[model samples]
Target: MELTRIGEAAGQRQTPEDLRRREDSKAANNMVTPQEAKERGITWRVAPPEPQVCQFCGQPIQPQGIVLQNMVFLWRPNVRCTCEKAVAYWQEYDRKQAEEKARKEDEERRRAMQSRIDRLLGNSGIKKRFQQRTFPNFRTDTPGRQKNYRVAKEYADNFAYHKAKGDGLYIEGTNGTGKTHLAAAIALQLISEGIPVICKTSSDLLLDVKKAFDNEGVTEAQVLDAYKKVDLLIIDDLGKEQCSDWSMSTLYSILNDRYEDMKPTIVTTNYNTDGLINALTPKGFDNTKIVAIISRLRETSTVMTMAWEDCRGK
Candidate 1:
């Protein structure tokens, strides 16, 4: 007769060989007590097997985990274990928890960045007309359009360096040749990079100044300072409106402020130099101020002419 351990359950006698094998497994991981095993109608040993019971179902004890303490257990599947269902469930639960945490963190970061972008764009004074235009949507069907697009993209990509070096651009083309589109693309790209850019048409800028004059509550200096202080200033449709004594003077002040400070400015226009001069100094007005403005623009700007016909029809 095989002798049972102290407090062994008084049922299901096991052979000496069988008892020895079971004892080895229990000693390695389980926290079994003879009295407890006897009450449960199971084998008696020094300890229970790892994960003695399925944590989820609390059914069928198995040698699936290691017993680190009297009752505490850690899952460590062994060859003799029959607790596959319980092990798989906990593994999947932990995995899903990790994934959900990561997703939430990513979403939070994205929303924070979008909020910052919105604030910067709001302060930029970019018009609603060109808000949707970007470099990818810019048409490059013609060779000239392609070259112009490439140059504009290069300028945008290296905006920090170009701005630091006091370089600017003069984009001249007929209406509908994508000059405004390209300029807007550059402004949007810089804005996305956390740089502030002001985009407005010459006519609108003059109207803003005029409104300041009419409204004594707003000062002209405050209005003008915004244009001069931005990282980039885009004057779209330059020379499109007839320059007035007040308009020309305001334009000179804004341009000269940037010129003296070495800030970058991009001017989009339909007129060549001669046409621009004609437009600027209409009715035999003294061309000296206009000449001075043009001189400063030419000195710091790389003139890019988009010769393609208007693509608005296409």
Candidate 2:
């Protein structure tokens, strides 16, 4: 018991010299004396130094003119009096300025990234040659016929089928029923995935083909080649083109070539199957050729019918 008590007492007691040494070590580590800082050429002034006399105008020095100066030269006096609070305020200001600068740089970087994405979506022709000839004008914010006319799940399935390099699609729907929207949506989605797509109205395409024929030396074969080779082609508003030997024959040739190659083509027509057959068969062209083209198209394409009540006014 006595030995234990003695040991406890010894542990509790510390010599005054030892205590002094500990304090000295801590002070040495933390102390920043003005005299030492002056030798190091660091000045932290909280206010202006007292003028022995004004250098510019002869005047007696005032006590209020003497400002406190730290060893670090970070703080300067606003007025003549030494005030540590002023130094604290200036430090806070500098910290805020640094934060603001960092935030601005971050915002600028975000804007630059968004700009690159926009360029890729809007103007870059990196996907394929077909993208160079067509512009996508669909907007997500358009305020009419909001519901998807194409059943979303089935449409997605069909999209997957085409995307897998399987075959083409045929969309049957009435006007104002979002058939064009579905076609545009598919094209836009493919574009995002780095695939090339060409979208053109059927009537406009026929007119262009007609113009190519009318201009001497410009063979329609070149135009037909362009139509036949794209990754995806969307022929919108079919059965609306003027029926003629050249128009019917040209359309059949493009469709037949794409069918044989197993390339995908999406056609949205207001006409039903019977009407389409009749339009393709219109008196002048060979009926067997028209039948053959339609048969090949049916063999390689999945036909989807989109039916929705007109919702433009409501």
Candidate 3:
């Protein structure tokens, strides 16, 4: 009966903390020494009879040494009543409970990570068609292609270093030279690693601002903040956009804010430095305006010219 109380007590509807407190209280009460028991006039036996019956289940309780506690030992120490069936049941129950808890925690973590990745990628402005671009699939056939690949890989690998210095890449080449591929690859990798990145064609960048200005539900400041404050901003097809005074001013403002804040930016272009200046600046507009944009673009970035054959036609 005494030995079986452990299982009986455990089966009670008490909270775990209450159960622990009850067990601790029981231990404190039963810790009387032989002399103390004698002094307290409590009847005691050093050795109890063998094979005591479990009061509830009728299983034989084995006698361990004289500990002056439970199991008909003239006092009480409620050992668990575990016949073979009960022992196996409790062990399996505990194992399953632990496994279920761990599984739930792992699933929660996975869901949270996926949510963050989605938000980052969605806000990154990477087009749906280029979503799957990655460094591993980029072909490096010729010398220039190989050099571009190496440099892009290094940039991505050491992104934290470049990001700190507001350093970026100026990729200039003809169409289908893997320029956009490498830039998209960089953005995808960083987003996967939980970094915030924005990749947009220069045209789309201006278009977004124009939409905000035209009261498309979002404010002009909000759109520009996203462009200026993101960890890395990639402006694709720089000189391809239809240039206007407003477009040049908007580009300069975003670039200037990012530059002053030490935020990194990547630019890809079909035109060389002088050609880009010419394309962005409208006819008869001050050369200094375009020169300022070029100056910052050149000074803040590592100029990489992709002179390889068109990758698309290949």
Reference-based lDDT, residue 188, model 2: 65
Instruction: Show the lowest summed lDDT stretch of 10 residues, model 2.
Output: 73-82
Ranking by lDDT: 3, 1, 2
> How well is each residue in 199-275 modelled by candidate 1, as lDDT tens digits?
88888777776766777666677678767766788898888776778777888899999999999999998998888
**Model 1 — TM-score against the truth?**
0.60
Query: Model 3: per-residue lDDT, tens digit, 187-237?
Result: 999878767778899998888788776775567787777787777889999
Overall lDDT per candidate, in order of appearance: 0.75, 0.60, 0.79
Provide the RMSD of all predictions against the true structure, rounded to 1 decimal. 20.2, 22.3, 15.3
**Against the true structure, whose lDDT is highest?**
3
Which candidate, 1 or 2, would have the higher lDDT against the true structure?
Answer: 1
- Estimate the lDDT of model 2: 0.60
Runs off by more than 4 Å, candidate 3? 1-122
Backbone collisions counted per model: 10, 5, 2
Off by over 4 Å in 1: 1-123
- For model 1, give the 10-residue run with minimal summed lDDT: 72-81
Clashing pairs in 3: 70-76, 70-77
A best-first ranking of the candidates according to their TM-score comes to 3, 1, 2
What is candidate 2's TM-score against the reference?
0.48
